[model samples]
Target: MPHDQLPTQAHAFLRQRHNELGIPGLARRWREVRAQIRANGTWRPTYDELAYAARVAWRNSGRCIGRLRWPSLIVRDRRHITTLHDVGRELAAHLDEATNGGRIRSVITVLAPATNAGPPPVRIISPQLARYAAWPSREGVLGDPANLALTRLATDLGWSGPTRRGPFDLLPWIAATADGVLHLLPTDPMHILEVPIQHPNHPWITDLGLRWPAVPVISNMTLTFGGLWFPAPFSGTFMASEIATRNLADEHRYHQLPAIITGLRLDDRDRLRTDKALLTLHEAVLYSFEAAGVSITDHHRESRAFARFAQHEEAADRVVVGDWSWLNSYPMTPQDPSWSRYYHPGQPTPALLRDPYCLALTAGHPKPGHEPSPRQRADVPPGRCRHTQPRKGGHVSTRTPVKAHRRLTRLAAAAVTLAAVTAGLVGVSGGPAQAAGCRAAPYSAKFGAADYFMQYDGVEVISYPKYPSYYRTTSQCRDIQVRNTGDGVDFGPFYACVNFYGRSGCNYWTYVPVGQWRNLATNVKDGTKFYVWVRIDMGKYYGFRAVGDW
Candidate 1:
């Protein structure tokens, strides 16, 4: 288990890939890899094979409707990067070349793989080169909801803002080493090219402050092929929906429609405002990119191109599989030919795989608080606070100021206190902390429950200036396998989210409550010390330790 000794099948797999790609020197490469496997229990692909694999991954990506142009991907061989400085330099170059001065070329830069056999390779953590800050506010998310945690992590690393975070702010690059140590990569401001959005038909649309980076460079995905993996950063020109429908129009994102509707003097009170604003926003994205001389493909045009590409693949005897939900998520779906069809999730010769969350935890996020969710009890009215009572059926309703009652009273005495306190309860409320000596200790009920198992211990809250976001684990713990059964949540095993602003700070915490959790001990034969954490939904991420039968 020291190194995944490349088997005979690996050599064949590489050879088939090379031959199918029409690359010369397939036999020589196979022999080279085979000898490396026999001698060192590893295989390092040649540059040609690496480039071919990168393109094949693009072709195999089922969710990307723009894969029709996979052959156009320009691969940069940077697999020799040793230090974080080199990564930043190479990534800047990738952005410059992919930006194409504004036209936006599709390109990918492949980097060094994980040297060790057990964990994933080092990867860039940002979803894109440019992202907004999701600061904690009484108002809704100021920037992209999807990038809230990353924004907080960037701020934690001493990256300050131009000022308070706005709807558009370029985030610095963050990458991890093979060991999972995170490093911040500073990008030269000039290298990031952003285009302001304007609508050709609606002249007033320019008043709305909306913009996006020219290139969508994804850095977190692992490129796996023939028993080898590379932390690859890939870039592509924007498809209109990526900018219009999702980035600009999605409620969690920019939520530009309300402003646009106001600017256009359209009636926003009507339910149809969202639908009308969506089309208008979609048109604005298409118009702005073109006017700015940026490269973009409208969904209708891209869908038509995809149909042709599918036919071309079929003629070559290749089954073109795709994810329908992603393909259909475009605007004016019925108008596009792609909306009419279903696709199989095709297997690629080389796949762009997502790195496991356990590997991601090596970046050193804080651990989670061992707090139980404040479940509303039947005795308490709908809006009243439900504090854990020591007795089975009885409850302690504190009408006293929450901060004052640090200790618990006897159930019979507490009932009398509750009667006196209910009048004052309208103004006073208990904070997160309560007396530990109470019949039921704070969060103890959650741990002692028969069905609830402790995943970690000694979790401490790490403070961020805006909101205390991360938790660090003091105790050692194993990774827990997680299955995201929710349709919207995209997380791996051992994911948790801590929202400081949850219900305006009452009933604020929840862990991996919905997943199918299991112990990874049997699988981790070497006892890999996995530092795991919970990335709560659109909130701060908390680290966790295993609570061993506590």
Candidate 2:
């Protein structure tokens, strides 16, 4: 659409520029833009206009929680670059400048914008300039499950990864030009600043060998302003939670929590073990980045900063719009100031918008008819990539030999099992009385079995201790009843016991059917603690609740 025909957006942006920056002669500039649009059906944004618009786009981004530094964003206007080679070179330069040797700086490189003549001159196909490759096999996904499609697409484009693939393998950059050509460019390892994840308190965490990029450069979103779309790639130092809580801890992503919990050897007897593990992971991510001199922020600090940003916006008579879900951190606590407040909840231009073609390309599925031909495959030679090279300072290379990688995998698996067994004890709550005068608390267990139908060969145990002040005893209670709360097949013939430390005196095993309660006889004692042991025949998950008269 011509800017002269629908001049509302163009006029709004220009007026904002005038109001905020006090740029004189706004009416004269608008007339010039109108004349350009009348003659050529589109108007070009001057470098000054483009830079300010990019900064304003960050300010208007509803999903961003770090908009406090909007005015400090460094914008690179590369509107003249039209070739894929130049795009690759500029991207490498962007990484070097933004990374800044671990003291990351926020930067955005704005390429050619979409015009009436054609689409953007160059478009980045990767979701982030720095992302790991995901190679799927019969065993499991070797890298990130989230990037499997993209990994497969890269391989199909003749970009074979290292001779021995391991997790945390950096993917090659993919770019497409207006002439329908695809280019696969290798990322220079020196430019990719990586921080090895290690916990300050837990030294064993380093053994797992996890690392993350210092700066996250988002490449797939378009910077929309004044009725034009620019394929802009932007970067900011990571927020610790984005790496620890989401990227590494999410089940569909790296899923490192279970391993971390196992390494911590936290007793499952504590009801908050999972939460503790998550916090520990967050601390490790923060510590690792800080130790490496990489710029990072914790959730609490970022939330407080955002609160201040909102205050400043309100002071300026600007309505703060934000997506509440995105603004708050995962594993969020009420202590954060952002937890209690609300904001105007809609997206407003100028904004960074996700284009469908970019999304598809990032997902490893290009536009159906635009698939690259045989000649378009750009594969790098094996030894030429620096990721496969040995580190200079006696540091271990990320690319482990295939045999060593398998051995490490086996050790990790063993550690997980041992951790589960060592911390097998569960906690149950004593709450309000249910029917038959029994106080119940809900409990659930995650089976370690990989197959859904296969039975977890290990025993699932729960204990109510006597020494802990918070623990409830069966002294006042007579009989204990257990109800199967799971949706899967029935479980148990539970063994109820009264124990002193490791020794136990128990009764005969009593069976409990699905959704039904079974009263099991227990020998109540003053000093001994109560315990329940059950085994499920099928399913990867089990849920139950125990009720006793207290």
Candidate 3:
């Protein structure tokens, strides 16, 4: 590889660390990293600071400095972006005893309530707790604000199922099973939902100049909610409340809710922040957790941090058994000790940040939303790693690997040819020009249950001597296409959109477009470092392709 073919700083650090001591490397064994980088790469490697650094860099991307001065763009409600999260949270069972069967399933969840209260108003249970779950209201089950609203959420959203006779009474078959739980607790916080939900179809405006930007979730502190096992949505935009609500009432309600949950906040209109650490708001806090960037956990060593989260999660589940929905219901809300103890006015929720297993999807950690901060721009140079194809019969495969990419890229490329103009990307530009093509995973045979994982012909491109792990561009974009080359692969438009680091030589581009714009919902940019992701999903023996704005 030529000098120009070097990986981006971030990618380089990841690869180096992967090869050096391996991720989660022991302190002493990996302690020599600083010396390692000093002797080789451009800078010294930082430790115990990945999230901290990402937080710093992402926040400083010049995106957060102002009050979000972008045009108020609305993509309209699509199948994927328009989830009834608020309604789901409201309708979910906070306790396990009040349900028809009296139990919520024990599983991961994303909680996107209109506001926060004592604790998460919704409760998702695991199978163990599911057996002991309960509904929020039992007996005659009067249409209380919560149950009525929640049930409406199910019906109005057109969720597939039987009768929506109250979320607790999840009509037999509909209530049978769920991937996880959604919690909705309404607090009188100065929320924006009250504005939008109050008028979902009506056009509204925010202090951020966003007109009817229904889904502007805050990022950092926003993602922090998932640290406590909370799932929020997309961006950290503002939620509009009604005029009747009092600013004092909202603040009072904010204070009334669980400090732990309520404390999880986002950067509101008052962009007043503390640079000592990143200042974030609700959705942003949630998105921080939803962030994805190369899986931190590798095949080697052990995830000591993961073990701790598992233990805590288990203990919490045990204490939450029974029809305790009543225990923390309406007037009798109780505080959670764990969150209370760790509550700091402005501090990263390490507890949530460290544990990405249960909260990965909910928090959006290994997904979209999480972007790199500016500070992280200064990193060590990247290097080469060995690549191999899936081995057959205990030997590396002699067959050539198929090239794969997100479907939209190819579609967009075709469209570009038809349209005869490249809009956003400037073609693959950081390294020497190499013909566009796909390469096989070098270490496929090493996969234990290779069948379980999705395989693709990951394309390797060279541009101007830079080796971007993924594809990218500078133009705005005109067309993006994708191709499915597998048989009966359960893949949909899962891999379509991507995020790229803009280069004023400084900032990269990042967008959270809705699923309807393309097809897939899987984020191609989350785990990426420098290049924009041309996401693709190909099942066994099949390959995927992508071509967009190149």
Candidate 4:
């Protein structure tokens, strides 16, 4: 029971337990852990300690926006169950408890932990407990593109999909147990509760035959608590945007925007048609889940709840670490309280760690090698986050270069009349010679959707970086022109700000309309340097260019 014999992580976890929960008998527990570690090289956590650690892991999960309900997580200890058949049985029970007859309770089932003297712990190889199978064909990928690797792995493991493979086919679970055997177990259809998507106003939208599972159970991540790693699968109800904007509407996924727009018989030529369609799809998901009496949350509500959670954490003297890009909702709006703020950054321990071997196994690659230790696996980087830093002037194109060129040509043609007017205004001033034709390169911008949410694509022009302030006269001012080159959509109510510093100094919100050139004049001293920034306010893809003379 010597202090030097116990690992630092175990001591740290015990100290955290005492500090956070005021758990009694800290000295006795510390002695017991030390003795256990001295005897067996690891110490087992009591059920209460294990449950608290799991809840803390959820509370510390930076990527989850619905962490406000972390305390409500139901932790089911299945450490005694090590065989594949038992693991599958427990997983089914977990699904049933999580599904909760459409109420969708947050639940986690913790299986056997890796030990020094025993066989390897039970591991679930699927990323999620209920993911659709993907099949490649001559036509194209028939199901979720994200699951292609998983489907291939399942097929290789002697798991056959439906007789007639189609979209929305449920995938079987792959589990590797302590018996050194890999097992492919099919998910019971009754355990999967799904709500059919349909719009209240648009009856024809039901023809799309889209449905989503009531609960999303993440199965691949390893839960690390009290210096022990457990294969813990957890679940929660879906955020509507996750299904509507990401899973079903992402270009790499179902890409249902075009189909929904076509179904609505909306003009594709209209710039705002895509925005309307996205809104409709989101609305449909909400309506369908609510009508079915299933639990689901929208981005707006989730954002506000996260803000409250942050407040509570701060009040309890805890730093709320988060990835801003993941916290922000897809199809981001200015109105969300969480959008304009930043959080403390760092991945805290007593958290879920992504094991590379487990990731590979889930992705259909089962290579033979020694599995990396938890310390090695914990170094995995966080996912992509939103970019807010200022970018240099260049032609940023989300589309092909040829399409960008065509848009640039059209932009030039449309700006001809405005250029002529500006030329006349410069000539009429006639005070001193000035650099009146300084133009920044055109840039493209788009709203948050799918993987594009992490990008900062906007029209930005900085004067000090390219053109010095000496190019202008004392009597003359600069007029910044922002032109939208996108397909006929009106973009803003967005801000066009002139800043002496960078984006941080941009305080003014000057609204600019898209599909045309609009001039915003900055009246400043001759030797002053400034920059103009413009970003879209609405949820639609847009292309814009900012040009100004110093």
lDDT of 3 by residue, 1-550 (tens): 1222222333444543355334665454344644453454322223333333333222222112111211221111111212334323322322211121311111112343212222223222111111101133555332222122223222221222323432222211011102122212221122222111111221121122111212222211112321122322223222112111111012311111122123334244434322211212232322322231101111111123223333443564411111111111111112321111111112222111211111111111111212222122222122110000112222111011211222211221211100001112223333212223321222101100011221111211111111223343212222222232223333223233323322101111122122223322223332232332332222221222222222
| TM-score of every model versus the real structure | 0.68, 0.66, 0.19, 0.66
Q: Local distance difference test, per candidate?
A: 0.54, 0.63, 0.22, 0.62
Candidate 1 worst ten-residue window by lDDT: 417-426
Global CA lDDT computed for model 3 = 0.22
Give the winner by TM-score. Answer: 1
Deviation of model 4 at 239, angstroms: 0.3
**Whole-model lDDT, candidate 1?**
0.54
Per-model root-mean-square deviation over C-alphas: 15.4, 22.0, 23.6, 19.9
Ranking by lDDT: 2, 4, 1, 3
Best by lDDT: 2
lDDT, candidate 2, 432-485, per-residue tens: 233333444422111211212111222233333212212233444455545554
- Total clashes, candidate 3? 126
Candidate 1 residue 88 C-alpha distance from true site, Å: 0.3
